[model samples]
Target: MASRKAITRSQAVKYRDASKAGKAAILDLVCAVTGFNRDYARRALRQALVPRVV
Candidate 1:
């Protein structure tokens, strides 16, 4: 099993934002830190951009 490190909230947000702008490296960094599939990370970032309904 791969050990995961805790990413700072700022880092996660930055990574997500960078990904939305089509930066592939951010996806890889997210995957490495969170252990999520590449496609899943991509989709997640896209979904995250939508404003949440309160």
Candidate 2:
């Protein structure tokens, strides 16, 4: 979802700039709410997300 990506990207700044504990907290919240894959979330937050080609 583009909206999801937009939301994630906005939060990406926080995620990328966050402290260790903050990053973990954000990841936990995101995962809990969106059921996003941890690894994928990590990538997205790093601005490394690419659309799936399936």
Local distance difference test values of all predictions, in order = 0.61, 0.75
lDDT of 2 by residue, 1-54 (tens): 786677687777788778999999988777766668988777777863444577
Worst 10 residues of 2 by lDDT: 44-53
Question: What are the per-model numbers of colliding residue pairs?
Answer: 0, 0
User: What does candidate 1's lDDT look like per residue over 15-53, in tens digits?
Assistant: 655634545777777778788888877666556556779
Score residue 32 of candidate 1 by CA lDDT.
80
Off by over 4 Å in 1: 1-22
Stretches of candidate 2 off by over 4 Å are: 48-54
Candidate 1 lDDT trough over 10 residues, lowest sum = 1-10
Candidate RMSDs in order: 5.1, 4.1
The TM-score values for the models, in the order shown, are 0.58, 0.73
